[model samples]
Target: MNDRWMQGPQFLYMKEEDWPYTSRENYHAISEVVSVIPTSKFESWGKLLRVTAYVCRYMDALRGIKRENLALSSEVFQRAERVLYRHIQAESLLSELEFAASLRKVAKKTAQCSSIILSMKPYLNENGVMRSMSRINNAKWLNIYTRHPVILPDNNRATRLLIRHYHDKFRHIVVNEIRKKYFIPKLRQLLIRVRKHCFRCKMNVAKATPPEMAILPEVRVSAFTPPFSYSTVDYGGPFDIVHGRKIEKRWICLFTCLVTRAIHIEIAYTCSTDSFILCYRNFLCRRGTVRKMFSDRGTNFIGAEKLLKTT
Candidate 1:
């Protein structure tokens, strides 16, 4: 490593290529921020910044300003949203939603009002924000914004972005918290759509994938074999059996035929190698010979097999 490299600045931000998914509204705000914020201070920092670093650093672009001059942290995001709304209006996109026909006592025939907005009783506030007219408009105890919540379009792209901004800023989408500021038509459906689109939330609520079936083993697939030809052995339980006055503990050594699905049970006195060997002999004597036996690697079963092989 070059020793002179240590002489450079401790921390620096390097700019990078354009972010494709960045909204046009935010892009304009980024431009607005870039115009006021000087790049000369970060001369040591590279010209192009990484995508992630850009997002992080953009938050603090106005950091060095004097206390009195510094804009509120929220103003940056609000400016972007305002720009977004302005762009929507210039395009005449939400014409039906812009004005409400039911606001006045007598409805005008020329007024173009959407059927969806009739029940909402929507009106424009002093700030020109579209808000719902509430019966509690006289309620001085609550905040004015709370009394008449901002009405948002259900299907607009801008509406989704605005909702995302609110959700990210506060981190909760609770009914009361959101109702204080905004209201949407069929809010339940809108929230569901938002949840579906969210990358992190969607991951947590993802649908479970069904496991694929495995290929059948040779013994199980062999249909022509007779009963006890290919046997699978397994222990059942240490069941209580009354012998005269005293009760004795015994295990059922279950032997099942793979081809015919016939089962043969043998009572073992204990779960030892000697007891298992005796059970195996009894099964063979009564049910004839077994060409192959499949079982889990239990200590008794393994020990019995080893002893039989050695003898």
Candidate 2:
């Protein structure tokens, strides 16, 4: 249907009702109908473009179909959609791509006069609609849409509506197939807008990105340090240990070196300050004195630390 555009009316499909631009008066009539839309919902053309970028509400802008009808067959809806798309391209995009179409002649070609549309090999049909030419013309196995796709304006109202129309149960995956029939600029941006506005998908399907971890502290990164030089102490459980015949509960004081991750332990029979002082004394004797000591604010540890500072 698209490759036949330059070949004239012979290759084109035009039914009586689908001819939105049968004459000058008829085309204006259709445009006027579309222009007479409610100003409240669409404050300006910009507003319409923004709204349609995700979800479209301008269903009856041209009164092309009776949307209020209870049941509309998929065939009728698709046909009306094709008519609407062509009408939209005729209204705005055709004029934008006029220079690109004129570039078909080598005489009109200029290095200074370049357009993005020209890169897509854009051409104007009999109705002055811009459609892009594809390199897959020799592949008879492919469909007409794959051979020549219509070049649509980026973030336009018509383009938005078409994207929303195809956005069904598949969600974002449909963008791949949409490339087959339309040459919309920044199509990924359009898909991003769709994803952002789609509340259901954003809430349920979107994954959270974890933040990066911070750098290690000086104590953990320091090298060439003696065992227990930069060390932290903590007291663990009252494990049962048999002393002669009777079993006794004992607490273990643990010391860990930050750099080398060396462990040293001392047994304290009770949780009293005297018992902890004896246990810390034994750890210092075996593991050597710590250059920096780190420990929780336990009363027993605090008392032992006060004595060590006083000494």
Candidate 3:
């Protein structure tokens, strides 16, 4: 209802504290969008969950970064910004009007920064082929410092700090990761040669006294006698989301018979105790009663199991 709220940030990121209130709005928005737009609605729901996860992580990171006085866009900061933008869109933190206005500018700046860093990778081969800085051995510090001077201006303290950090992390190191990735074939060839040498030596050497082997005491193994022979009933069905005022197309709950491995399935209009009980009872009547059951600890399943046992 406040015009000032709309004008605060073009793409406002919501904190977890705001979730209770915003969820109502998000639910209504999703309903309106899903009813009219025939696009992949489930994808939108997945994005909502993803955004929530990202915001929670980012906010926590921001607290630490702010405390240390590090800039968000600094190369040395070492957090991926592309992921952040994706989170913003997924959470629907911004209204459609505000989102459309500011998305391009912020996204473009983040992408430009990434490109600048990506271009500074050192060329390892003499043939002008660009290789990772990690591939060159012996003089890694000198190689990176010389090749990526564009990223490290003498005057920029942040750039200087980044260069120092990079050196401290990896300078003078023979990068085993590069060797593992690119030199596996060479290692295989060397292994074959060594194996041949071992075989020849084994034939020439006199046989040494074999070490005495000792037999250990026998241990009894328990026979796996399961409490229940098998699940007499099994079923699988769709679960529609109905709580917290968010748009959800549907989810699935699968059931199985432990013993017989028989399956029953139904599509749920909404995932509720009633829906679960109806489907489960129908399955039992058709197949048979199960001796034991295994299901995800969802509320519906737990409640259904309790009610079923009572009857």
Predicted model with the maximum TM-score: 1
Model 2's alpha-carbon lDDT is 0.68
**What's the TM-score of each model vs. the native?**
0.48, 0.47, 0.24
What lDDT tens digits, residue by residue, belong to model 2 across residues 1-311?
68556666642366766655545554433332234433245434344444332122234533453456444445444444444455566555554555555754552354224546567777666645567777887998887677777788774666765566556445757777887777888888887777677787678877988999899989888888888899998889989999999999999888899999989888888998999888778888888877898999999988988887898
> What local lDDT score does residue 227 receive in model 2, on the 0 to 100 scale?
82
> How many residue pairs clash in model 2?
0
lDDT (tens digit, per residue) of candidate 3 on 1-311: 78667677533557756544434444432212222322233233234334334444455564563435433333322222223222322333223212233445464444334332233342223322222344345655554423322111222222223223333344333233223322112333433333444544356565878999876322211124332234433334444566689756553445554433444555554578887777776766665665556667778788888997798
List CA RMSD, all candidates.
12.8, 15.0, 30.2
Which regions of candidate 1 are displaced past 4 Å? 1-121, 124-130, 134-149, 153-182, 185-193, 199-205, 237-248
- Residue-by-residue lDDT tens digits, candidate 1, 119-191: 6677654545566788898999998778887666666655555556555555555555778877766666766
Ten-residue region with minimum lDDT total, candidate 2: 49-58
Q: Is candidate 1 or candidate 2 better by lDDT?
A: 2
Q: What are the clash counts of all predictions, listed in order?
A: 6, 0, 4
